[model samples]
Target chain A: MSELGFLFAGYAVVWVALGGYIIAVGRRQSTLRREIARLEREFRTGE
Target chain B: MTTVSPGSTAQPDATAAVADGGAGGGVTTAAAAPLPEPGRTLWLDILGVVAILSVLVALYGAIIWAPTEAVMGHVQRIFYFHMPSAWVALGPAFTIVFICSIVYLVKKDLRYDRIAGASAELGVLFTTITLLTGPLWAKPIWGAYWTWDPRLTTTLVLWFIYVAYLMLRSSITEGHSRARLSAVFGIVGWIDVPIVFMSIRWWRTIHPTLVTGEGMNLDSSMEAVLMLSLAAITLLYVYLLIVRVRQLDMGSRLDRLRQLSHLR
Candidate 1:
């Protein structure tokens, strides 16, 4: 492939890696928050 | 801007993951505090906005503002993104891991562990970019996609060491043991960074020298774009770190609450 081809490819790899990391973190955060809320409500009523 | 939603924290969906399914299923006094919403951080909004803008400006500077290189033609343009990814990986990312690892070891605080883990993950992400882009630039210029040059080899090793760090964090079920063990490895893993930096100077290698000082020469425009790109990447790293660290903090707290509820 041409040099420009390589250049564009590199940018694509960068964006994909960074974007994926962000999305993964977001997913984990949402799951954790949901658990936290559920546990808190259960504790409130039990008390 | 206010970062919080000012209402009850968390959502209904995450309930399944941390449900005290085994517990008698009742709210306790310890669990009354609301969990902070991870997405609502004001700092994230501010930093995210700034990072996006900087990346846009850096993108323009890298492709349009910087003049093309005479020797390598357009391929050298990849240097703008390429070098900064390596820079962030070797510099702030690992440094944060190293610093936080030490602090975690000394203080035994889970917060530092969270920061170290987050930074290590981000470090690996950027290093993957570096590793990927290096080969792309090399293929057209060096006639091969892979080389066992000193710098490249050390960088690859550096990447693996931190990859192991992440694996350790995820695989260990207990939080304290995970933090303790990973802290040790995190410190050890960071030892390779300086070696990676000095490899080109220490051995006969194909990798370019550091872009500034020490008898190296870079065009004014090239240097400017590189700096801008580095700044943009740094901002992005900070934003990511903020998001990741906050999430980890919340996760750790939830784990504590789980333990507390289990005790009743």
Candidate 2:
């Protein structure tokens, strides 16, 4: 790859890694919240 | 009514425990209430905002404010991000794992283990960034994507060590046992960090050593940009650490609730 190509690729990797991590964490947070809610509902209804 | 401080080890009162008080009723009791979700505080909001802004500023300084190197040209620009990512991974991320692991061993508090686990995850993440970016920068300059050079090899080893640390944490079922075992692994794994830092100096390698006994070899403007990037990345790591620790704490509470519900 050319120098410019290499430069862009490096920056791209950084952005993608950081962005993907943030999104993953956000999704996990949502899943955990949903699970907690479901469990709470189950407890409340005596199911 | 209990509020969770983001990284605090304080156990939240479980509704399942309350429900279990009736012994055989399961959830038939009227006293059982939903556990409060870990809510975001105003400080976390400010931290999120500041981390984003600082990263933006660091980006601008890296791409525009800094001068292009006569030798490496635009590709040298990658150093700003590359060095910072490496620093964060090796410096704060793994170091926190080391410290928190020791604390967990001493105090036997699972909160410290959670922090250690969260930091190790981020450490792997940033190390991945470093490994990927290093090869990209190397391909155009070193003419090879990878080599068996000491610095690179030690860094790769460092990454695998922490990856193993995380995997060890996941393999165990019980909390205290997992914390105890992983704490030992974490402490031992940290021995590799300093080796990675010193690999270039200790051995023959193509990897460039930017710092010396005197100082970093970067030009003044380049140095400024690098510093800004370091600060930005550190802030980002801190913000993420707090957020992840909070999530882990909540997950712990949920696990306890599930266990109690099972006993009913």
Clashes of each: 9, 0
True contacts kept of 2: 0.68
Over A1-47, each residue of candidate 2 has an lDDT whose tens digit, in order, gives 67898899999999999999999999999988876665665566555
Residue A35 of candidate 2: its Cα lDDT?
A: 60
Q: What is candidate 1's lDDT per residue for B1-264, written digit by digit as tens? A: 224422224444444433655244543544546556645767679889999899999999988888887767787777788889988998899999999999999999888988998999899999999999888877886787877766677778889889999998999966678889999988887876676657645775455632222232469988989899999999999988888888888776776566555445
Who wins the TM-score comparison?
2
Tell me, by lDDT, which candidate is best: 2
Q: Report the lDDT tens digits of candidate 2 across residue range B1-264.
A: 254333333233554444444345444534656565555788998998999999999999999999987666898888899889989998889999999999999999999999999999999999999999988987876577887666677779899999999999999967888999999999998976676657644675454643221333578998899999999999999999999999999888887665555444
Runs in model 1 deviating more than 4 A are A43-47, B1-39, B192-217, B261-264
Q: Which pairs clash (backbone N, Cα, C closer than 3 Å) in model 2?
A: none
User: What C-alpha lDDT does candidate 2 achieve relative to the native structure?
Assistant: 0.82
Tens-digit lDDT track for model 1 on A16-38? 99889888987897788767666
lDDT of 1 at B142: 71
